[model samples]
Target: MSESLTIVGIAGSLRAQSYNRQLLAAAGELLPNDVRFILADISNVPLYNEDLESALPEAVVTLKQTVESADGVIFATPEYNGSIPGVLKNVIDWLTRPRGQSSLNGKPAGIIGGTTGMFGAVNAQMHLRHILPLLNMYVIPQPLVLISQIQNKLDAAGHLTDETSQKFLQQHLDRLVSVARRMKNEQ
Candidate 1:
């Protein structure tokens, strides 16, 4: 039997009740048996500092290692003031360190999110579309997920209970796995 593909997920929100994190949980439940989703811990990642770039903190090292080990990455972010959240951007900056030796190089990635607003995390995903390519990531093009009205989609335990949302998430996960598998085989 083939080994399960590992996808590292990063939740951009730091809030305990963040809809994006809940969306990630939902995404996790929908993944296929051949795909394993591992959520990256963002709580301990410090603000990006060029001086510390040479000697990354232990948390940052672990984060990089997690991404490096994964077959792909999924970024679930919350749009903040018409842009990506500060913490999310900071994490990306840290991941893109040493000028030209980014950990995301040649990795496949998918972006999705949930938000209270009507547009969900559209702006944030757009920003990532532009930014990720610069870091040498092969991002998926079609079927971007921006889950709006998040409060109505998740249960009290932060699990996605809405059937329609689950279908949507499944579609995205399917695409992520497909693209990630192709990338993995190419290497």
Candidate 2:
């Protein structure tokens, strides 16, 4: 690994006070202090289009570069209806185009999510798990972090106040980082 291990965290929500964004922040805090954790900004990426393929937007270019340089990614997706949010899916679409030039290709990835619903974004996470491979990412299978009825678990400041949720999130991050380390070493 290039002297330091790096992980990029992407929250699937655009809302400033989004629970998913808080979840991503918690993941960042749970990680080892030495790890270089980045909260990826997806706010500026325009919608994907074939017509715009030849001239990729600056935000897309930066997003791709961020993911392409990282050892692993953590996606904190919020469920919409019974599926992943369109914004998250839109970001994935932007990363996956131009044929074989995807920044996410073969990158180690982990999914974490929370929702006000009872299912804790499980359905959305399942959908996202299925979609990762399409972007050529390898989803980490163990220690899944799914937060259902997330409001009860977070404090006003957005930190996870529930022990159970914190434990699960920590375990998931540990596993993700371990896998990332292995991948980086192999490179």
Top of the candidates by TM-score: 2
- Residues 12-60 of candidate 2: C-alpha lDDT, one tens digit per residue: 9999999999998888899887788899999999888888889999999
lDDT against true structure, model 2? 0.89
lDDT per residue as tens, model 1, 37-133: 8988989999998999778899999999999899999999999998899999999988888688677998888899878889878899999999998
Q: What are the Cα lDDT values of the candidates? A: 0.87, 0.89
Angstrom error at residue 5, model 2: 1.0
Candidate 1 has its poorest 10 consecutive residues by lDDT at: 161-170
- The segments of candidate 2 whose C-alpha lies over 4 angstroms from its true place after superposition are 1-3
C-alpha TM-scores of all predictions: 0.95, 0.96
Off by over 4 Å in 1: none
Scored by lDDT, model 1 comes in at 0.87
Model 1 Cα RMSD, 1 decimal:
1.2
RMSD of each: 1.2, 1.5
